[model samples]
Target: MDPGFIGDGRTVAVAERSSLTFGVEEEFLLLDASSGVNLPVGDDVLARLTGQASEQSRHEFRQSMIEMVTPVCGDLQQMREHLAASRKAAGDAAAAIGAQLVAVGATPVAEAAVSRPAAERYERIIRQFGPVALDPALCGMHVHVGVPDRELAVQVCNHLRPWLPVVQALTVNSPFHAGADTGYASWRSIQMERWPSLGPSPYFASAAEYDDAVQQLITAGVMLDEGMVLWYARPSARYPTVEVRVADVLPTVDDAVVVAGLVRALVATVTDDIRAGLPAPRLRTSLLSAAHWRAARDGIEGQLVNPLTGVLSPAWELVDDLMSLVGPALTRDGDLQAVTAGIDRLRVEGSGAERQRRIHRAGGDLHDVLVYLAGATTGSVAR
Candidate 1:
């Protein structure tokens, strides 16, 4: 990457309201349940996929776990259809290989010895981020939707900051790490936070400011290049959209789709609000942190920080309030029910963290936690 090129400066070639384009990618762990250890499957899976494209699909993360990508769709129905099919394909591949894909945010066992994904660039990720590099502990979901203009993407990135914690709250699925209870709903969030670039980022007054930050990181060697600066959220380097990376790895495909719906609505709401020339709200990163901490600590059981009043409130109440606040956006994006219902279900049922704790309580064995997750890996489950 040229030190001067902070963003690709790519404008959407065919942006249209009737033709909204969205895509989401989630990471998982590849493990053998009986042994209860990290298993690297990327190489073998990649080789198999390359030989017979009919049975396997490719994931940049390589194949320790599979990633499913959906084509850009005009409506939620189309997106859902593609997601369902993609997920089935991934599940089929996992079964054929005798290794199931586990969707928990952080794997129960992420020891240092696991091999890096087969890529020189990702190896550079290890090089750039250093100890935070092993972020083998990292797993997340990222959403991308196209925009007509590049600046609009930058503006959307700025405006979307206030609501990121909402994404953080809705997808807190990782509760265990390396056979021990880490006590964070999404241990991956805390683990990834160890990276220098993790946390609330500066609000870019313009893409120029965004570019400047990238340039500075490159100059300081803090980042190998723009790609290394994986702030909680950032404008996608390869696409003409802002990529939101705040959520943990959701357990089921439905949870993944629901979180995508909310994030897509939130982004469009912020974008449309900008198009109308409304005064931008002051998105407080500090307030966002408090909200994030609650999501990390209590998951669905505890109160969340209100984005407006800056006070803690019950998680159910906050979820209701956010769904209401983003109603217009949700409706405009055709994702209102899916996002809201998913939130309600999660609020009522409990977070993955809570479930893991309950399973441990009942069995009085940590292996049972792993055993359950192993079985849970192949199939989908509601929160």
Candidate 2:
């Protein structure tokens, strides 16, 4: 007999309105404080944060990476507070171990030996994926927004496909890899796309169709389990939420919050559209993947393939369109002002990748890049 379906009977609770509640998960590179090299100190950091008020810090695939998940937050402000507290606590722990937590998409230094975490699942990945499994020395931020039911969650994931590249463009913070500038805004995206499961999720007719595909992948041995989907967006395996996994770990806390708020507003907009009988866009997955590639290559500094028109246009113009698409939801959540201000600030200051390039051009080395990243991760600018 075939294995049982995992997401059966998941439609028991349908949310009539968007809860607008959300959370954020940020992954950070642990760096040696003195040398700015990637350091395998995540175990020490997790041990320090293990028995705190809540289980916030967790070990990622690589020992040089740590991840923190915030509690469910009602608004952008609450999300900011929780992220700030978590970053500080983790920073403190890392500092005690002669390491620093750096909010960067990829480490500038090459890893001589991949440091695998002690988890059996991680070991399995290492054994299965070879070099690609160790590629997550890069970091990213995932935003989780609540949905009422699995069906709606899957619909939101479908509706969210086209807009994901815009999200990636806004959060492209990785411009360097292996001790030199790779020139792409997010080299991490390039590294991650090596995995078969990573990219825009295909449209599904229903929640069952989605679950069936996941089970097929498991049965085929391409993935270990449902948790390995790693699509640009997916229904959270653990929570009643749709997780957006397209963004890099931004350099600043406020940037992270702005992205989270935008994602929440997008979900609200999509859910409302679905209720009004609007069908999700039927773009092909190959086109969606191409859009993501352009976004990662150019970030906000160059052209983006428009999700709606499929035309090459200025990245900022696409971002403006994105803002307009979710404007009503932002107004409903009272986050219009914060998100608008954040966009304005970002426009003036540029994406984190631009900022890193500027620092590197100013005669600063990779160690200097690490210092800047560490300071920005703590909500301050360092130059």
Candidate 3:
């Protein structure tokens, strides 16, 4: 059976014309506070969370990671507050067990051991994937922006394809892996490429086309379910939002807020274009995949493929193009100033991957990189 298909009689609810609500889900690595080694204690950390924190947090595929999700937020400020509180809550819980909740895309230190929680789904994944599941776990950030319905969500994803590489460049936080420099800005993204059903989503003309693609993957044993699509962006099956999963987990709350605000504005801009009867650009998935790889390799430090022109340009120039594209929507959402300031900071300080490399170059080791991540995650370090 095709799980992605929605019956024709189902009514779809459209979002209001007001500001679109959005949220973020961040996955963090649990590391030994002193030794910087990965710790497989996700269940213990969850047990320490109380009340709302307990409700919002959960374990990931491996015991060395935990994920925190913020409630739906109406504006960027509200999103910022919720993200900060959620990070603090989760960080505190991890600290209670002598573990540090580090906002890193990949574990810097080698895993002493790998353990999967006793969940049937996770067990099945490990059984099916074998060594791939046992590889050093990677962390990522997913931004959910409210959309009207599945059909519109699919169209929005087409519009979103051109910008995914830019978004990935903005949040490249994983540079070191297994206590050594990997030379790529987002090693987590590289690790994820090992999956069979991962990379840029194909451009779909309607909801039915999207469903058909997912069904084909399932039938071919490329994916176990619709939730396993693993595309850079997709119409989330469980939510009424298009989930953008291109970014690595950022190193700081401020960084997360910046990405979230930009993403929301991008969605708003694209939704308006769709309403105005603008046709989505038909860029090939192969070209998008190449652009994505360049973003993962260079981050913001070098050149990037401008998806609009299919040419190589300085990364910041492409970033400027993105800002110009989403400028009006940012203004409408009252996020222009904050988003501008955040981009400026990223320009001055560099992406999280660059910052990690800087710390390592300053007579520090990978353990020092972990310390910086821990402090940055809790807002205790200066950007």
Of candidate 2, the 10-residue stretch with the lowest lDDT total is: 1-10
Query: Each candidate's TM vs. the true structure?
Result: 0.87, 0.93, 0.95
What is the TM-score (0 to 1) of candidate 2?
A: 0.93
Q: lDDT tens string, model 2, 1-383?
A: 00111222322122334446677889998887776678877787788874531377777888888898887677788788888888888887888888888889987776555786788898888787887776648899999887748899999998988899999999999999878899799999998888878888889989999999999998887789999999999998887788999999999898998899999999999999988999999996667888999999999989999766779999999999999999999998899999999988888888989988888888768778778888888766632
How does model 3 fare in lDDT? 0.88
User: What would the per-residue lDDT of candidate 3 be over residues 265-288, giving only the tens digit for each residue?
Assistant: 999899999989999998976788
Q: Which candidate is the best by TM-score?
A: 3
Computed on alpha carbons, the lDDT of every model, listed in order, comes to 0.67, 0.83, 0.88
Model 2: how far is 160 from its true place, Å? 0.8
Residue pairs of candidate 1 with colliding backbone atoms: 42-63, 108-178
* Per-residue lDDT of 351 in model 2: 91
Query: For candidate 1, what is the TM-score?
Result: 0.87
